[model samples]
Target: MWWYTFAHVVYHLIRWFPKNNRLKIRIVIVLFSFGLLFPQLFVLSREHSTRYCGQHLFDFLIVSIVFTFFMIGFSFIFSLMDPVPWEVKLAFHIFGVIAFVMGLTLTVFASLAVDCRNNTLELYYLSVSAAVLTVTSFAFLMVMIPFWLLNYFFPNSVLNRKERTGVCYEPTACCSCLWHI
Candidate 1:
C-alpha cells in the first residue's frame, strides 16, 4: 500500500513536466492504486462486523469518496499548469470518473462480504468478490508499472520540460523589440 502511494506521488511529480495532461493521467493512476488498497481496509473493519455490515459499508463509502475528491482536486491543480488539449484532459477525466465509481462500488460490496458471518455461503461470496477486485487491481497495476518505467528510463522521450523564456523564439519577437520602438 505504501509503495502504491509512493508511486502515485512520483508519477504526479513526473507529470509536472511538459504538458499538464500528465497530471490527469497521474490522478487516474492514484485512484486506481487506491482501489487496490481498499480491500485491505475491510480486514480492519472485519473485527467490528457485529456492529452491522451497514457500518462497514458506510465507512468504506466515506473513505472512497474522500479519496476520490482528493484525486480530482489534484487533477484540478494540475490543470492550472501548462495548457493541454481539452480532448486529452477530458479522456483522462472520463476514465478516472469511471474507475473511481467502479472502485467505490466494488469496495462497498467487498466490505459487505467481509462483514457477513463466516459460513459456506459467505465464504463463497467473499472469494468471488476478492477474485474480482484482485484481478482488476492487478490489471491496472500491470499497465501502470510499464508506463511508469518507460517514462522513467527515457524521461526526455516521454516527458517534455517547459521551454525556457526567450530561448525558443526569434530575437526579433522578443519584448526587446517593443522597447526599441
Candidate 2:
C-alpha cells in the first residue's frame, strides 16, 4: 500500500540527517511520531468494537505500530551517525534489534491468537502478546529517552571532535530536505 511506499522513501532520506543534527533528529522523531500516530489513532477508532477487550487490544496494536514505525524510521539515522560514541550507537542498535525481535514475536502470537475468518479473538493469548509488546516498547523508549535528551541539550552529541573519526555534518535546511527533492 501507500504506507509501504512512504516508509521506503523515509528509510532512504533518514540516513541523510547529519550526525551533528542530534537536535534536528530529535525534533524530526517527535514530529514524525505525531504525524503517524494520530492518523493511526483515528483509523483504529473508526474500527468497530467487537468487545471492550478487543477494542483495547486493537489500540494496543496501534501503540506497537507507532513505536515500531519510529524505531524503523530512526534506524537509518542511528546507523549513519558515525561521529557518535560507540557506546551510544551500540546501545541504540542493540535495543532497536531487541524491539524488532519482540515486535515480531508479538505479531506472530497475535496472528495465531486471532481467528480472522471467524471474527473471534483468542483473548488470553492476544492479551499476553500485547503485554509483551508493551513491555518491550517501554524499554526501548526508556533507552532512547536519555539519548534524545542528551542530543537535545548538547546539539554536538556525546563526543568531541578529537574522539570521533570524522567531522560531524551540521544539518542545513536545504541539505536535510533532500527527501523532498
Candidate 3:
C-alpha cells in the first residue's frame, strides 16, 4: 500500500519530464529505504535505548521524515539531468545539497540534545519541524503523482495490455480455498 501510494505520487510529480520508469522505481526504493524501512529496522533492532544520543523511537521517526525529505530533494536534483540546462541543474543540485545537509544537521542536533535540561524548547522546535515536513512531504508527494496515465506527459506511448507481461497468479490462492468454511 505504501509502495502504491509512493508510485502514484512520484508518477505525477515527475510526469512533466520524460518517463524513466526504472529511475522512478529506483527513486522510490531509495526513498523508502532511507525514509521508512531503515528507521523501522533501526528502532526494532536496537533494544529500546532511551538515551538521546542513542535516538529513542520517537527520534527515529523524526530522523526518518528528515531523511525522506533528503531523498526527495536528491531525486529531484537527479531528475534534472540532461533535461534542464547545465547552469540551472548545477545551481539546483548545489542548493539541494545545502538543504539536505542543513536539515539533517538540525534534526541530528535535536535528537542528540533531546536529553538536555533545556529540552522543552528543543522538542517544541522539533515538533514544529515535523509538522511542517509532514505537510510539505504529503503535498510534494501529491505533486509527485500521476501525470502517469496521461499521455501528454510522457515522451513515448503507454504500452498496451498485450504488449506488457501477463499477470501471474499465486499457487497459494488454491491453499486458501481449503480453509473456506
Candidate 4:
C-alpha cells in the first residue's frame, strides 16, 4: 500500500517535470546521487569514537530522511525557476544545507538524548531498522527507475494476460508486487 502510494506520487512527480526528458533525467540522476550518499554517511557514523553516536541507526535514518526532504524541496524550488539567478540559487543552496543540519541535530536530540539508555537491545533495534530501511529505500529506487523510464518512454506497453483481453498493467506494476506491503 505504501509502495502504491510511493509509485503514485513518483508517477505524478515525473509527469510534473517540464516534458523535457533531458531535464527529467538530470533531476533523477541528482536525486539518485543524493540517495547514494546516505550509506557513506552511515559507514562514517559507524566508525565514530563515541558509542552513542553509532548506536542509533534509526536516528541516522531519520537524519537522512530529513536531509532528503530538504534536498527534494530545494530541487522543487529550483525547478520552478525559468532562468535561475546565480545569487538566488546560491541562497537556496545555503538555506537547504542549514535546514538539513538543523533537522539532523533535532532528530538526534529527539531520538537519542531524550531516551533512556539502559537497554542494549534498543541499540540493536535501531541499527537493524536503519539497515533494513536504507536497503529497502535503495532497492525501491532501483526498481522504480526502470519502471519509471519504461512508463516514460513506452507507456502502458505491458499486457495483463490474466485479466480481460487487451487489458494492460501500468509499468509501476513491475515493482508493485515486490513492494506492495
Candidate 5:
C-alpha cells in the first residue's frame, strides 16, 4: 500500500520536475546540504543512541532521509531525459522500487547478523534472498532494455500524428487512458 503511494508521489514529482525551475534549484541545494552533513549526522546519531530501540529509531530516521534524497536524485536524473515517454518513466519508477526492496532486505540481514550470530545459516538464507531479488530487479531492467533500444533505434516507427498540435490522434490502448487524464 505504501509502495503505491510512494510511486504515485514520485510519478507526479517527476511530471512536475521538468516544468518547475524553482523546485529544481531547491532540490539541488537540499541535496548538496544533505550530502555535506549526512555523514556527521549519522555518526553523531550512532554515538548518542545506546539502547537498541533508540539506535533502530536513529537508523530509520537516517535511512528515510537518505531515501528521500535518493528519490529526488532519481527524479531529477529521469527528468533530464526530456524526450522519453511517460511509460518509460513509470517503468523506471517500478525498477527503483525493486532496487529499494533489495537494498532494504540486505540492510536488515546485515544489521541482524551481528546480534544473531547463532543464526548464521538463517542470515545466509537472507543474504541469498536479497541476491535473488537483486537478480530479479535487473532481469526486469533487461526485459525493458530491448524496448528502449527499439524506441531509440526506430523512433519513426512510433507514430505521432499531430506533433505540432501536441496531440496523439491514434493513441494506443495504454496511452489513451493517460491522454484522457
Candidate 6:
C-alpha cells in the first residue's frame, strides 16, 4: 500500500545521498516503519487472546515495540553529523537487523502457537501479513544501508566529490577549496 510507496521513495532517495548518510537514513526509515506497523500487531494480539500466555505475549510485544520506536526516534534526531565511522555504522545496522529479525520471528512463532489453541485462521493470516511487511521493510533497509555506507566511506570510487562540491566548474583553475563557491 502506501508503505510500499514510501519504501520505494526511500530506496531511490538513498542513491543520491552521500554514502555515510545513506545508512543512517535507512536505519531511520526502518525504525519509523516498525513504529508504524506495531499497532496492527497489538490489535491482532488483543483480539486473539484466550489464555494467560496470550496476554503476557501481548504485553511483551507492546513494550518491545514502544521501546524500539523510542530508540529509533531518539537516534534519528541525535545523529546528524556527516561521515560517521564505519564501525559505528556497522554496529547500528547489525543491531537493527537483529532486532527486526528476532521481533518478526517471535511474532510468527507466537501466532502459530496461539493458532493451535484457538484454531483460528485469522491469527495465521495476521501473523503472515506481519511477517511479510517486516521482511519487506528489512530488505529495503539492508540494500540502502550498505549502499549508503559504501558511498560515504568511498566517495571517490563511485562519485566525483570534486564535481559535487562545484570545484570542477571553477573558471580560474585555482587550487582553493570549494568553500568559496
Q: Pick the candidate with the highest lDDT.
A: 6
- Evaluate residue 173 in candidate 5 and report its C-alpha lDDT on the 0 to 100 scale: 41
Residue pairs clashing in model 2 are: none
TM-score of each predicted structure versus truth: 0.34, 0.37, 0.28, 0.31, 0.33, 0.44
Looking at model 4, report the run of 10 residues with the lowest lDDT sum: 1-10
Top of the candidates by TM-score? 6
Task: Please give, for residues 1-181, the per-residue lDDT of candidate 3 as tens digits.
Answer: 1222333344345544455555765566466545644544444344433334433434644554555554455455444443556785465446445544544445555455544424343343443454455445445535433423333455223322344321111222434221110
Task: Count clashing residue pairs per candidate.
Answer: 1, 0, 7, 0, 0, 4
lDDT tens digits, residues 1-181, model 4?
1112232344345444475554765467457646645553554455331355444544554555555555555455454454658886576547544644544454444355333244334444444444444345445556666655665666444343355222234433554342211
lDDT of 2 by residue, 111-138 (tens): 5554432343344344454555456555
Give a tens-digit lDDT track for model 5, residues 1-181: 1222233334444564446464665466446545634543544355433334411433444454455455545545554555568786676668567546745654564555454333333333333443344455456556655655665676634434446222233464446433211
Candidate 3 lDDT at 151 equals 33
TM-score of 4: 0.31
Off by over 4 Å in 1: 1-51, 83-138, 156-181
Clashes of 4: 0
Which TM-score value belongs to model 2? 0.37
The Cα RMSD in angstroms, rounded to one decimal, for candidate 4 relative to the true structure is: 12.8
Each model's lDDT: 0.47, 0.49, 0.44, 0.46, 0.46, 0.50
Q: Would you give me the overall lDDT of model 2? A: 0.49
